[model samples]
Target: MTTVALLDYGSGNLRSAERAIAATGAETIVTADPGTVLAADGLVVPGVGAFAACMEGLRAVNGPRLIGSRLAGGRPVLGICVGMQVLFDRGVEFAEGIHAPEAADEAGEAAPQAVGAPGCGEWPGTVERLDAAVLPHMGWNTVEVALGSRLFAGLDPNERYYFVHSYAARRWELTDTGRIAAPLVHWAEHDGCRFVAAVENGPLWATQFHPEKSGAAGAALLRNWVATLD
Candidate 1:
């Protein structure tokens, strides 16, 4: 049986994600063991809560090193929700009255300044607050799937996924490095603001939404990813 390490770095929707992936018939292990994480057939990094806090926890168990080593060997790895966000270069958390530059009003006035936390830098972009009037773009939303997306294979284009996040990577800045193939990026919009919903780049695949909580469609997505482990 295929084995997947569900990284338990003190964050993420652990039990739910574990049950979801295990439902795909893959043996899932929720662990903080670096050796197990790197040795598994696949690794699932599921995370929730603030960006900085998640990073702190991830670093605790050498999460970044393990992820980097896996990708270096072309081993498959998956990231969910905040797990996906930390894959980027940085994440800026805005204060109560502040907003991201992308969230600037029509008048072009600047929002209050905010500090950023360093991310895993797997991709070149910053996770920032969405411009939507609503604080969290909670609930269900459909994504604009990228052509040839294995993650969305066998799923309807209009299928909605469960999203419960206010911050997202609003841009895809990783350009072709010539040696590396370009990443396929899926997008979603909320109140006129667009953000990256998912990305499939070689050995690394990620979703900004919680697939474990997304019902049948989510199962299909996880199955699709699990299929790629071979």
Candidate 2:
């Protein structure tokens, strides 16, 4: 049986992700141990709330290194929601340094705040807030799947997945390293702003939507992800 590790970095919808992956007939373990995380056949990173807080939690358990190590070895790692956002170079939501320093103190010294918090950097680009009238783009939305995508395999093109997010990658950052194939990108639009909804790059896969909360369509997506493990 494929043993999957649902990384517990003090964030994420842990139980839901666990039940979802388990339904696919894979043994799923929710843990924060570095050893267990590294030894798992597949790793699932799920997160909720603020990006900076999530990165702090992940660092508490050395999650960034764990994920980096896994990806370096070409192992499989799946990120959901904020978990996916943290895979980028940086998140612009609560970014620091851009703001001017506070007023000088009595001694003519200014208190400079820290710079922007870094992400896992597994992928290029920054996760920015969506430029939409409505705050969170919550509810069902359809994604335009890339041709020959394994993540969306066996699923209809017009299938709708559950989404509840306020920030996403505006555009994919594609670099020609001349070493690997280009990543397959999926796009979804809300309130006239289109954003990257999903990405499949080699052993790394991520979705902006919550497959666990997506019902039947989500089940199919999870099954497709599990199918790739074989």
Candidate 3:
């Protein structure tokens, strides 16, 4: 049987994610062991809460090295929620709100207000607060699936997935260098501002939404990804 390793770096709903993945018929193990993480047929990196904090936890367990090692060898990896945010270059979490700026310093210069946390840098782009009237873009939402997206394959265009997030990658910055294929980027909107909802780039796949809590649509998406595992 195929085995999937869920990286336990003191973040995410491990049991829920494990159960969701296991439902796809793959043997899922929640482990922080380096050996198990690298040797597994597929790896899931799930995260919640603040971006910088998640990075700190991931670093404690040498997650960056393990994930890099697996991807370097063309092994598959999946990320969810803040897990997906950490995959980007940076995550800018504001202290007050998106529109609120900090008071100027004594020198009459604007003080740095936002907490700009660095991410894993697997992809180019910054995960920042969504420009919307509402606080968090909670509840169900639909995504515009990318062409040739193995991740969103067989999913209906109108299929809605559960999303509970405030910050997200507002744009896809990575361009085709011709040397390698461009990544398949999926977009979703919240109050007119669109953001990256999912990404499928070679061996690495991720989603900003929680698949484990997304009902039937989420389950089907998990199944599609699990089907690609060896």
Estimated TM-score for each candidate = 0.92, 0.89, 0.92
Let me know the TM-score candidate 2 reaches against the reference structure: 0.89
* Over 4 Å off, model 2: 94-115, 177-179
Q: Which candidate is the best by lDDT?
A: 1
lDDT (0 to 1) per candidate: 0.91, 0.87, 0.89
* Tens-digit lDDT string for candidate 3 (18-74): 999999999999999999999999999999888888999999999988998999898
- For model 2, residues 8-116, the per-residue Cα lDDT tens digits are 9899689999999999999999999989999888999999887889999999999999999998888899999999999999986633322223332444666555435
Candidate 3's C-alpha runs over 4 A off are: 96-112, 177-180
lDDT of 1 by residue, 154-174 (tens): 999999999999999999998
How far residue 230's Cα lies from its native spot in candidate 3, in Å, is 2.0
Please give the lDDT score for candidate 2. Answer: 0.87
The alpha-carbon lDDT assigned to residue 71 of candidate 1 equals: 93
Clashing pairs in 3: none
